[model samples]
Target: MSIPFLAGAVSKLFLQFGCSEVRVEGLPAFVERLKGDRGVLTIANHISVVDEPTMWGVLPISTFYDQRTVRWTLGASDMMFNNTFDSWFFTKGQIIETFRGKGIYQKAIDTARAKLDEGRWIHIFPEGKIKQDTLTELRRFKWGVSRMLMESKGGRGEEAPLIIPIWIKGFEEVMNEEREFPRFLPRTGKKVTVIIGEPINDAIEPLLAEYQRKFPHPWVPITYGRDVQEDLKEEPPQLAEMRSKIAEAMRQELMKLGQRVPEVEAREPTKIEWNW
Candidate 1:
């Protein structure tokens, strides 16, 4: 096995082994979205540092063998690409090197868009950072997500990539940021629940329609999301509105998904779960 694939397989097993219990709901949506022909944009709330490697364990083991079925994610350069080995590791894991204050139009975002165009799956933490607050209380989403929304394309014209909102609970407990000792090692016996939401087209289509109506040209150029376009001189007022609306809509969807999932508080593998 390739280094990346082997690492992924081990992480998947490690997640299943570490947690006291891990549960997943709405897995069919996850299965269907990835299997679809169009690019997929998965937005999830950030809970812990291990979110990427651990949360992905929800996927079937067979999916790991197919790198395309795995996700290409935007990771903080400082966190994931600081040193030589780490950079190599994260890159092999399909993570794009993203800077924190560099705004959204940098090479990382563009790389992400290109990956999406290839019918790949891109997962993002819309909150843009780890916020281990209440499951229902989510941070305001960054406009980068809006940029991805406006920029990502499916096979057909004007067809946005499938938007799947995911809410992962209990990952934070595996390696709480608050823990001081043995900080790098993942703790065992934690409960985790993964809640996959349905496609959010219905909630976002109206916003997209309004964006098209007002712009009439296209919602392509995002000040915070896309590379610098030639025609873009000054950003219009509506662009900010559109980006904020899209970001907010994503937040709302995730919060609602969290509410629907009672496992967060109960910490039970309530529904049908894929576990060892």
Candidate 2:
């Protein structure tokens, strides 16, 4: 499975499905910053299932070529090979599956390391799940990304992969969840935008750690229209603080990059959502 072939296939599929006019920013500068280095990690905000494909479609081909030797480690749950076509596409993309509590952490790290050594890139969504709510903003980020960066650098030293933070917008309503696909009337298709922010090098950790020290005291835990209380109970104090800070930092950064949609204020969890 050739990477270029799969990238084209995925890019074509998104283009066919009304993903027109992808607006990409800062790629040229970022590419220049990378300076022929490809072994890197991209951290993104998860808004929809199409995010990965959209990213692939928009990334500069030359940048990918520079990092031609890399593989993207995708979430294990993302491997939904419902048919032969899907399986083929996934393989071609060089996507690797990663999971928790399955002794797969080292595998993901190793895979990323190998790709970096080969002068390629790896991509991951710092936000683990898709946020379907129109009003709800990005959820808090897990510690996995931080942990990965820290550990990778610890072992490799100067060979650590660079961390790039990418903020994307307007991908939530690609397909209407209520009426399913092709059921709703369309006046104008939504516009999708991807904004690539500056990369985070080893220097950013202390700032990140500083922010992590301030999260979660007595403020409201984010409610997602459900009894997510169980999920909230076990959060360690430091971890909870870290997540909150990440969410805040992400929100601020996205807004600065014009990726934040404030017109839609997120709603509290509805009764129906809780029952469900």
Candidate 3:
């Protein structure tokens, strides 16, 4: 009745070396929901390049044995796929490369959409990049996440993905972007905490319903350089506006969980409370 010893040795190793005290809340529900055959979208605040993997330390080591419980995440092509060795490693890690400036209509997103259609779990750092100022504010989320969230329906009778928001505290101290020399090694003895939200499917369903009501058409993928950079020039006005709103809404949702982070960082986490 036990999971294999080496199931999550990698995350266990990090948990041993990276932080001193680690506390997590609401993960059991997150893990349980993944058992169903529905697309799952999980979003988290990105404090460092390794936050996603590093934060995995909290999951029960046995959780790694079941592919159903794992998540597929997007990685920056420029950094994660810089070389053949790096590309091969990231690919095996269940990460897909997303170009920084490219629009949401790229191959990586297409792959993510395809995976979601297959009922796979897709995690995204909607901020699109690492933000060192997580204690003060979270940068605005990019539209790519919204595109994945809304267009996932594809008018194919596939159910929309279940949405989950997570907030992590303390990765910034482990891998400070400004650290000098021996950058590859993570700083030790830091305190870390993770809070997972229950499914916010109800809140997102309204937006998806509104989006579907407005579009009522199949999605077609396209990309134009500057236009993509600007307000998705090729997209319909309603679409462009809605994507921005959905991304912002997710950001705000995580912000609700973030209220406890500052207190945690100051060594005083309050009685945990979140309003979904």
Candidate 4:
């Protein structure tokens, strides 16, 4: 499916769900700052499954930017790219699948790096899972994004990638994990807000330190291989440590964005009345 077409469809779906008011902050200026072939990595809080498509629909339309720049998102293979239809849709939607158990997870990182090298945009949910509990609280972020950023910088030489932190509120009220689809008619006074923070160009060490201070327990390291022994062999002690630090740092950055914004109200959906 064409991106422009998908964007249109998602926009309509968002409207049908009573996404009446959408407010974007700090994204237009960031778009204007884009020069020739500069790569962008967007890190956002995952509130619902609709978060990805909502972002796709909202960003271009809200910013009045060109839709031709390919937007790549890293998604779980089992969840987002399970079947042929989903695979096809997500592929066209620019989702790069990350098969968790499969040894080829690195391939996804490499693919993202390649896209970034070509001056495209990549979106990652560093939190790794949807926060169905609350919009204010964020889950511990996984380390894939940090590793990806490091790899991208190494491949692109002097062209450093920009990391944009985004905070989206009201998606949980629109559609949570309990419902597969967004409500046909939204609750009264429901609004979706997407707040894009300024670009982060600093080193990852400080952010990583902050994350470690908050969550003292170390991140469970990821091992890649067909079997346990092979997995152990593939991941050395030092490399695993580095990856964990980077992942936490990325998570911290996203959590910081969430902190800056006001907490989204946790509302229980009321029973819908269908006029027969």
Cα-based TM-score, every candidate: 0.86, 0.63, 0.86, 0.74
Off by over 4 Å in 1: 154-157, 216-233, 263-276
lDDT pick, better of 1 and 2: 1
- Model 4, residue 207: displacement in angstroms? 8.9
Could you give candidate 1's per-residue lDDT for residues 1-276 as a string of tens digits?
665557666666776676667777777668767877788888998988888777777676667777678888888888778899999888888888998776666778778877787788889998988887665699999877787666555312377778888888787888787988889988889878888888898888777777766766544444454333332455676777787898898889888888866745465564323433
Number of clashing pairs, model 2? 2
| Candidate 2 lDDT tens digits, 1-276 | 356545645554464355544456666676554566555777777776666665555544443443353336565634645568876666566766565444323455456656655556677776677766742355666544554543344233335566577776666666444535465433126666666777655444554445334431322334322232343474456654544554445444543544332321132211111010
Each candidate's clash count: 1, 2, 0, 1
Residue 92 alpha-carbon offset, candidate 1, angstroms: 1.4
| Model 2: how far residue 150 lies from native, Å | 1.0
The reply for model 2, stretches above 4 Å from the true place, is 1-3, 9-20, 33-35, 61-71, 81-89, 100-106, 134-136, 154-160, 182-188, 207-276
Q: What is the C-alpha lDDT of each candidate?
A: 0.76, 0.52, 0.74, 0.63
The residue-by-residue lDDT of candidate 4 on 170-254, one tens digit each, is 7777765565444553343457777788776675635444444444443233654343235556555655566666666666667
Ranking the candidates on lDDT from highest down gives 1, 3, 4, 2
* Per-residue accuracy of model 3 over 107-163 as CA lDDT, tens digit each: 887788778888988998888778896464788888888878776873234578888
Clashing pairs in 1: 20-190
Q: How well does candidate 1 score on lDDT at residue 164?
A: 87
